[model samples]
Target chain A: MTYTITQISIFAENRPGRLAAIAEALESENINILAFSIAEASGFGVIRALVDDPERAFKKLSSLGYVVSTTEVIGIKMHDRPGGLREISRMLGDAGINIEYAYAYTGRPNAVLIIRVDHVDEAINAILSKGGQLIQRTELA
Target chain B: MKYLDPRIEEMPRTEIEALQFKLLKTLVYRLYSFSDFYRSRMKEHNVHPDDIRSLDDIVKLPFMYKKDLRDNYPDGMFIGGQEDLVRYHVSSGTTGKPTVVGYTHRDLENWAISVARGLTSIGLGRRDVLQVSYGYGLFTGGLGLHYGAERMGATVVPASVGNTERQIELIQDLRVTAIACTPSYMLHLSEVAEKMGVSFERDTRLRTAVLGAEPWSEKMRARIEGSTGIKAYDIYGTSELSGPLFTECSEQNGIHIWGDLAYVEVIDPETGERLGPGEKGELVITMLQKEALPMMRYRIGDITSFEDSVCGCGRSHVRISRIQGRVDDMLIIRGINVFPSQIEHALMSVPELGEHFQIVVDRKGALDTMLVRVELKSAQLFSDKLDDLIRLKNKVAHQLRNNLNVAVDVELVSPETLTRFEGKAKRVIDRRVL
Candidate 1:
């Protein structure tokens, strides 16, 4: 089985306190936000976050009236050095897999890269064949 | 065209005048003796009831302005008291005092009869189910069409305004054959229907529409009728003559004004001289049979030519051309009359807004959208928080809607964002393409 992580995306108006409301709901449920990024378009923003409990976060945010969706993304553990992104990107590019969007976070020893790709299964096989390490959901906990 | 009452509708031009002369003589005699408002108006113009010898002698009477309605307002212009009145419809007045129209039971009957005849001219009858989509309350459009459709024995759906998706469903589930609404609303409904994957031709059995209350183009008619495969007829009337009084017959050439109910004339707005048939000018009408609020030669500010010739549909009623434009600056938004002064009046009540505001009106997907971009007093008026801005914008928009009775989009801009004194009607930027 492939290692796929669930990322929660929240549709929010690009206004102050919107992010805080979403965060407040997650906090109330004791759901830890592992990694988060804000993608802004027009007068609104899409807030993508990786949480300790995807299902719990989805319910809490929805009940609180925040529009949220869960998407499966590949989190790759990479070298914390300068060529970490280039190496991972070039490996997928050589295999003809297109990365739609990506973001990264750093912890001790290594950086974790979260990427959304069209051909998820094929990209995972290519990266695994190249000896790259994929981050598991439990590893963050 | 079919006739609901063939005796009156299909009568010869001479007989139409005979009916008009009989009603006019009775109306003049009643007003001269009973109504101080009409008696005084006639005396000032040196005309008596005896002066009105024939239909053409209507020129001897003085013209009544919209100001007459305003000056009298609520009850002053009315012929009888509340005991004699059955209903009242109020319209927006330019000078803040709303013009109120009162109707007795007989007056309502005549209005419904007029609508019945109009519906019949357009080929809608008892078997057809009509949806009166015009607003229902104090404004006249909704109730006027409702009564007329009911009188004609058409099962009427009093689906007055808004709830586009639900109205679309009713059109399908109820098998609504005809609808009465503004031309803009028809376009909006069509656009919404398309979004819901509902085709008027396929999903619904809508065959006709009676659209009016605001000026629309023949091109707009072609656009609506051509796309939706529904026959769109132009309905014409102002609140002065009891809301929607007449509509275009099957000929679709001009809106037929029933000769028995009202006498029609086109006059040079400047000189007050009556123009011959086919001459474009202001429309003046005398409501012959109205009892509660009998209006004689009320100057309706709409600009159009008068057609006295017979319509191809075989009706001998006088027809008016499609309203070219208005001599007044009244703006009709989604069938409701909106005045620019009313916009300023709404803005004055809001403390957060500055004096300078620009009104941008545009047609989006066939529906008219009015965007009011007003300047905030200062950035310090509210924080940059999205909630605060939206709340304040909604407040301004809510104030506008409450005042004007039409939904509008409000944009909050920084002070000095609006340009000053560009031209006449600088406060408005109407980008609507006809």
Candidate 2:
């Protein structure tokens, strides 16, 4: 199995200025947001971000009284061209792996697609054994 | 360290009891001889004032209730005529007709003395400036604390509840050192002050607050003290007892009920049998010196207990624990007695939970069920993992079970969903009768 990436999920109320506050906190600590996604829940939302420094970001945000924690998610490096995305998608699909949620950000030469799947170890095997590229945590920094 | 009335306040317990019995005997004779209401109540109970030889024999007297005041209406139970009355304060009843309480010169003086002792206990003195933020008019709070603050030689600012900006102005301009208001009002004032860019710790001179009139938990007190950076002491009394009186001293353990002015007892609400010290039960009070409105063993209906041990403040008065919910708010959930205040006390202990909560009780099949729906604090205190959220729910349930001795289900709701009350917060919805 390949390696897993750490993502910070902030439990925030669905109100104005909350996202700004989170971004301001991250900026104050000089933590760069590599990639992030926001998901809406019942009257609350989660802002999952892949920052340059997950450990520092977690401590800073939590210290500012924001509900924050880190979770292990898989970031797959896929082809930059169209239909190149099919290479990793088909490998996981044919292997009977389910993609719970996925979002992509442009990396140099290729795109690093962050996908949280139900089965972590199996998804890592399905991708890595098939010669798929896995982005290291240092590569994001 | 100085007492408002040291002679009686610092007396020994035996001496305090002697004074109480003497005052009780005098009050009973006055009630039986002057008022028609007490004369018939004693006759109806077949008990005479002559039978009361000792303090413990107070049980021989019939218990008075809020109902008695309502039934008597205006001046029916008063000991003196309108010519003898100096002031009148009517309590607005939520259920029935309002209760009119008249106070003669002596009655008003005793009321102020009660407040004077209470303010002194909270570490306030003539050097401090007091803002009476309670509502004036028919409400006893404003005028009661007003007179008390004057008697204690403090500069008085009759703010009287409203105009938040002006209240803040007075607090800053007058350099008010203390305030007497309801607990909710204190929270509201702090909020308003924050909006006006005023800091309680830096801008204002408020060092202490005597908050009461509403059922507030210790956690709430901690929140107020934490937020305002002031010592928040609990002052407890009803308009029926002559406004806000008997506050927690600097120790902030319990309220010091002056043994000379009134005698307090904890009685079983169901059986009227007196419970020993430290046992939780309904509180019954007898006004030993009230002139215009002579109340004898008035059933207060507030559930609490008292300790006869002298307070650390050096007063020999009995101090009762903060008022747990009123008797009417008690619910028998799963055959276990529960009060909403107990649930509030349990929930407020967790800083993550908001002050608002709703208790919903219903019967599922043949078994009874209870559910508590609470919101998160507005600023934050949330969780991302389902397991972490579940752990919080379990912890809250455990606290509730420990306090109420009944199984309860907890649900974490979103902020701004629960209703916020300006006066009294109604937190229970029992749907079991259907």
Candidate 3:
């Protein structure tokens, strides 16, 4: 079963050294950033990260006065070769599952793609039908 | 013109001084006879009522500070008994315990008259509909403007703060001709009006604005006038001196203090030496006719200068410039004095920045660090790139350094993030232990 993986998002002022400060705070807490993305708005930036410890990272980041929230995302494991991401994207696209945002990291044998989509259940079914392995939440921990 | 009270408004300077002397003599004698606080204070200085023969001799009397009011607390300095009192108002006391002020029936009447005079000077009349937007109740702004507008025969809306949507609707529905509120709130109103598609120039009959209760600049006056299409005038007074008492006339030069009701003097804050005309210093005032609580030589802690010459409005009363800043609000950064108003003036010059800002002062080891967090205007916020934002931040910091003569850290934030105040806005947050 492709269970939902929780990802943490932090709202921060769009300024120099703000991201470094957040990174320093998470590093101090021993939280490893598995994947991360930065979304820039008009005068602020949102840092969305998939960390090894979502609960710990959320708590540590929030205590430092950063507006933070958690969203459920599905992670997929595909072959590390080219077309790994294309295969998963084609399956989700064929099923009409919209990917709101996505980020990826490649390991030696496999690549993990973190996908935030509108229809989570349909995307999971599409990935399963295409023989794509779903990364479980407990595997990161 | 249309004087609220022609006799006092038309009185000559010499006659006003004589009247002030007579009232000072009576007030000092009464204080010596009744209130132990004033009696001991006067005796400590070895001054008697008879010593005050002329207005110049008023300098010999002791000066009272805001701390004195706090030390006296609930009722130590009030002369009359409980039976003689008609009303009481209090300071906001955001810093500490509230200082109390009482008013007799006559005191209330005179306060109404003082405000009425100011309202009339700015061309408010019976035919005008005035929406009193200052907070009412314990704070003097609401009731002070209320009574004055009523006395001037203007239809009073009594809209005492914080219903923004309804306030705009009232302006449109009732055809409000004038408004009295803090200058910042007026800017907020204008912003809200624009969003709601209510243009004051086309949709409302608002013609006059009497802004006071906080220090504002001529730049702000020009901004308000340009946006709302109303003549923005400054009104000045403190709760201890009877709410808002003086206002700018049609000429819009400076505030015309009523000479017959209150005597004004500017003294060097450090030396207590009276400064000449056009010299800025601490403003000290003596109420000539307050019955319940007559304030004599009260140091109001505001920094301003006096204009000696007669105003173009044909009034001989001494006009004081807009309050620069309070002695208490002055920040000494790296041994240099800086007022928030100066910083505001600098920031307002830049069109990309919004009106809301916060001054955060912290001590980093042995050095004092000032961080100014200002909001970007909505249009600027949308169009600014990362490099442009950094350049804007540095530009603002450069401007602040030039104006304050002290380096400051400027942090540009998103629009509508910094807090907007409906009442007296608290802009400075000092975190230094000292």
List chain A TM-scores, every candidate, in order: 0.94, 0.92, 0.92
lDDT of 1 by residue, A1-141 (tens): 548888887655555677887798999999999889887543555688889899998887666545456788999888888998889888878888887778899884479889988788888888899888898767655
The per-residue C-alpha lDDT of model 1 at residue A89 equals 82
- Residue A91 alpha-carbon offset, candidate 1, angstroms: 46
Candidates in order, TM-scores: namely 0.72, 0.59, 0.63
Compared with the true structure, what per-residue lDDT tens digits does model 3 show for residues B373-401? Answer: 98766532232123455677789999888
Which of 1 and 2 is ahead in TM-score? 1
**What is the Cα-based TM-score of model 1?**
0.72
lDDT of 2 by residue, B1-434 (tens): 47887897799999989999999999888888988889999999999999899999999999998778868786688877899998988764433246688889998999999999889877789999999998787777889899998988888999997798999999999999999887767877898899999998999899899887666688878888999998998887877877677888888989999888889999999999999989999999988888888778988788999998888888888999999856777665532346686788889888878788999987664245899988766546444555566677789889887766568988766555578889989888877542
How many pairs of residues in model 3 come into backbone collision? 0
lDDT of 1 by residue, B223-292 (tens): 9989899999999998989999999988899999988889999999999999998899999999989999
Candidate 1 vs candidate 2: the lDDT winner is 1
lDDT of 1: 0.85
Clashing pairs in 1: none
lDDT, ranked from best to worst: 1, 2, 3
Off by over 4 Å in 3: A1-141, B330-434
After aligning candidate 3 to the native by TM-score, how far in Å is the CA of A58 from where it should be? 19
Question: On a 0 to 100 scale, what is the lDDT of residue A103 in model 2?
Answer: 80
